[model samples]
Target: MKKKIVLAYSGGLDTSVLLSWIKETYDAEVIAFCANIGQDDELKGLNAKAKKTGALKIYVDDLQEEFAKDFIFPMMQAGAIYEGQYFLGTSIARPLIAKRMVEIAKAEGATAIGHGATGKGNDQVRFELTTAALAPDLEIIAPWRDERFRTQFPGRAEMIAYCEEKKIPIQASAKKPFSMDRNLLHISYEAGILEDPWFNAGDVKYRDYFTTLSVFPEDAPDKAEYVVLDFDKGNCVAVNSKPMNPLQVMKALNKLGGKHGVGRVDMVENRFVGMKSRGVYETPGGAILHFAHRQIESLTMDREVMHLRDSLIPEYAKLVYNGFWYAPERLALQALVTESQKNVSGTVRVKLYKGGIHAAGRQSQFSLYNPHIATMEADPTKAYNQDDATGFIHLNGLRLRVNSQVNGPANIGG
Candidate 1:
């Protein structure tokens, strides 16, 4: 019996060629799997295309709800942002796709899983690490890392020529300036023209290259728009008083945020692969949700718990970005993060204006923000005693006073 390989196929130029190449090179039957995590029209005609490209069968699963609920929501709750700017839109999607790919491999009795992610990129780590964590025995076939494959297709031009020779239908051309990966959470652009870190997307010559889910801030509406998000246990449950499931919440927010150009990030980030790469992303809905989630957290979460979780944000973000979603450390951090959100049920009103997200108001049934205790006016209720602060300050400053005396007044200004 021929060995079977389940390939992560996107029906894009790289994967289109990969599907055919894997079958011919390995002398194996290739099964194509595409996870439909909010790709919208990108999922169209993939089944036919995959089979025509030599796939024995194709599995295109609709994973949007699972993506939003199981993947995107938990990441948001943990406030996992890569390098403090990236929302981890692309990073978070990898584990879910790889998880499904592993399942398909097991179900089909395939001995290996294949991906088109280049060896130089983070997705290669993300996809392979996920497979390693889940199913260590299954072999991972990365064509881009294969010397024979690289030799044959040195660049996009070669790939296109190979496609034409094979009579494989592909929409890619040499003139295309960048590559994009879009799921429901975001659309990320990198490579090609984006490889130049100094290239300005705002320039009139290149203005049209970067946007998909959002308009440029300069093109947004003149007036600010207000959006109210309702959360239960840190999950966004509604938008503007309309109850919605996780999927609906994302869709609604994406539309609102896109209109105001709320989530466009262009940054150079250190990839887990030990290289800095430039990435441009549009995460309209995610920005609104992250801001609103933090606002709600501020109103409801305990002080110490919030601080502790905040300290773990960078570590958690690194694990996710580096493809350790199923690792024990990440799971342990997730447990703590989940506990911190128990009281984080609330509503947050946000103002969106030309790429800015502002927390206008936030309220919760479990709100810890006591306005009466915080007020400066005469406190007839005496909710907080002003006299107690004098003693508290004195005790806290005792060490400082002793250090100053012993150190000869700390040599002010040297």
Candidate 2:
């Protein structure tokens, strides 16, 4: 019996070539696996394509709800944004995909697994690390890093020729200048023209051809759209007063946000592989959730707790970005993040317009915003006495006063 190897196949040119190469090189039976984490129509006819490319069988798992509830919500609650911009859309999905890959490999009694991730990118690290963490004994076949594989097909022309000779059906006439990774949360575009940091990623030529989730901000409607999101313990439960499941909530938000051009970002980010890459991303639903989450946090979260969590945002974001999702340190950090969400239940009304979302209103039953104490209109006997500030100010500034007296005030016009 031939050894069975599970391949994380995408039915793309690279993976299509890889499927045939794995079979020919190792004399192994290849079982293709595609995780359907809400890529919409991307998975359509994937099984047929895999079989045509010599796959023994194909496994397409619908992971939309799990992606949203397990991965996205936790990251959102942690406020993990890589480099203060990216929502870590691609970063957060890898571990879940690898976890499922491991499960399938075990069930099928496969000793080896393969992925089409390139050696230069972060996906290779994310996939391999998660696999190592979950099932270290299983062999990981990374074709991009394989010397034989590199020698056989050094470029796209060779890859395409190999596919043609093997009778593998490819979807495109020619290789695209750019690359993309799309999931429920976002669509990311990078490489080729985008590799040039000064390139205008949103130029009209690329904008019309590439944009699927959103219009350009300038092309969005003149009027703003209002959306009300309801949260229970930091996870959005409803939109516009209609209760929805995690996937439905995202779909609803995506529709509204897409129309308003709510999420678009272009940045040159530092990859975990020690290289900077410029990419453009559209994260319409995620943008809405981020804005709404902050609005609720402001009302319900304690000030000091928020500050402490804010301080850890960069570290937490780094872990996800660096493929440490399954590491002990990330798990421990996430515990603190989960604890901070106990009272983050509320409704946030958001105003969405061209490329922006503003929290118009927010309220919670467990709100810490006390009106009487915060109000400017004062009663002499209110909880916060105005006279108390005189002593408070003097006490707080005593060090400054003493320093001035001791130094005899430095020269004013030096």
Candidate 3:
């Protein structure tokens, strides 16, 4: 019996060729799996393409709802943003893809799982680490890491030529300047022309080609738009007072945010593979949700709890970025995040104008913000005692005073 390998196939130029190559090179039956996690029209015609490219069978799973509720929501609750800028759109999607792929592999009795992620990229780590965490016994086949595969198709030109020779239908051309990975959350662009860190994507010629979900800030409408997001325990549940599921909420926010050019991030980040890579992302809906979630959190979450969770943001971001979604450390951090979000139900109104998001208002039934105590005017209710601050200040400053005297006034102007 021939070995069975389940390949994560996207029906793209690389995977199109990979699907055929894996079948020929390994002398195995290749089963292609494509998870539909808000890829839009990219999922169309994948079945025909996969079979033509030599996949014995194809699994096109509609995981949009699951991806939004199960994966995206939890990460948002933890506020996991890679390197303080990236929303970790691509990073978060990998584990879910791999988890489903593993299930398909087991069900099909496949001995190995394969992916087209290059050895130099983080997806390679994300894909394999997920497989390792879930099914340690399954072999992982990465074609890009193989010397033979690299030798045969070292560049895009070679891959395009090979596709021509094989009569394989591909949408890629050598002239294409970059690669893109898209999901319901965002669309990320990298590599190719983007490899040049100084390349200005804002240049007139490249601007339209690079940006998909949003219009450039300069091109957005002059009018500012207001959006209200309702959250329950840190998960966005409605938009503009209309109750919606996670998937529906994302769709509505993406449309509103896209109109105002809300989420566009361009940054150089350290990949899990130990390299700094430039990535451009358009996460319109995600940006809005993150901002609104934080706004509500400020109103409802306790200061100490918020501070503790804020301190763990970097570590939590690192775990998600490095493909440790199923790791125990991430799970523990998630538990704390979940507990912190118990009272984080509220509505936040934000104003969007030319790619900028501004908090308009926020309110929660569990709000800790006391207007009476914080007022600068006379406290009619005497909610706060003002005369006690003298003792409070002196006591808190005792250590500073002692250190200054002992250290000879701390050397005023070195």
Candidate 4:
């Protein structure tokens, strides 16, 4: 009787080879688990492919709703962005996939879990860290990191040759310059030809990678459309007074924002492994949600609270990017940031048009915008005394004035 292992199978080049390699290396029965998180039509023929690659059983879980509801929505609610650009699309999906892997491992009573993540990338960190957090007892087999496994394969060419020798059906063998991982929240491209930061986005070689505005929906009619987003305690619940599930809301927004070319970014970001990498991303749904969330925060969140929350965006982004989604520090920040949104119940209306999205109107029952205190009109019974400014300015400027007077004759004329 052989020990069993649950493998995170993508039905791609790496995982297909990994399945056979792990079986031969450990002599274990391998069950393949592929989580379907809005991959659209790419899920086709995955079961057959996995089985043909020496997998005993395949689990194709429909995790689209769960991915959006559990992972994407909370990150959006916090307005989380990595280095002011990345939507953390690939970074965010790792934990959800790893969680499922642990569940399947426990059910199958598997002693080991395997993944296809490479040694040079962030996904390796994200995947293994989540496994360590969830099921530390389960053994992890990462062939890319193993010298013995890597010695047999030098690069993609060797990987493809190995697959061919094993009669494994594959998509593309030679590595495309840009590696991409696509799901509901976004599509991310990195490495390969994109390593050159000077290459213009409009360059003919990478033109197809760019998103253009010519394909906007006809109903948009080259004009801005306004919609309201309702938030309660950091979660967006309604759009224009209509209630919605988190996944439904994201799907609706993606359709609306995609047609208008919203949320496209190209930037060079620092990776946790001490390398700077250039990546392009498309995040249609997340853009709309981010704009809407900030608008509601402006209306209800206190000034210092907003600053404090904004101050942690970089650190929060760092944690998520480095695969600390389940870490204590991230959880603590999440609690404080989310707690500040207790009074952030509101509706923020945003106008979205061809490649342009902005907040237009915002209102909330808990709004702190005081018309009387903020008004410019003259009133005899003023809540704010005008004379207070004279004393306040003098008191604050006293030290400066004294210093200047003492040094005036020597420094001023000279």
Clashes of each: 0, 0, 0, 0
Q: For candidate 2, which ten residues in a row score worst on lDDT? A: 201-210
RMSD of 3: 1.4
lDDT string, candidate 1, 1-414, tens digits: 999999999898999999989999999999999999988899899988998898999999999999999999999999889888999999999999999999999999999999999988899999999999999999999999999999999977998988899988889655668889998889999888889999886554555887689888888999999999999999999999999999999999999999999899999999888899998999999999999999999999999999999999999999999999999999999999999999999899999999999989999999998877788888777888989999999999999999988886766684
> What is the C-alpha lDDT profile of model 2 across 1-414, one tens digit per residue?
999999998888889999999988999999999999878788888989999999999999999999998998899898788897898989999999999989999999999899999899999999989998999999999998999999999898998888888899986567677888998898899897678888887776676755789888888899998999999998999999999988898899888989988888899899999999888899999989988999999999999999999999999999999899999999999999999999999999999998789879999998999887888887554778889999999999999889889997757895
Q: What are the per-residue Cα lDDT tens digits for candidate 4 across 1-414?
A: 898999988888888888989988989899999989877777899999988999999999999889888888778767789988898988999999999999999998898888888777888889888989899898988999999899988788888889889999897645676777778888777777778898765444554565532222332357677878888876788877789888888877777788877777779998887788898777788888888888888889899988988898889888889999988998898888768888988788888886578878888899999777777887545878889999999999998889889876335553
Candidate 3: list runs displaced more than 4 Å.
Answer: 411-414
TM-scores for all predictions: 0.97, 0.95, 0.97, 0.90
| lDDT score for residue 275 of model 4 | 81
Ranking by lDDT: 1, 3, 2, 4
Worst 10 residues of 1 by lDDT: 202-211
lDDT of 3: 0.92
C-alpha RMSD values across all candidates: 1.4, 2.0, 1.4, 3.3
How much lDDT does candidate 1 score?
A: 0.92
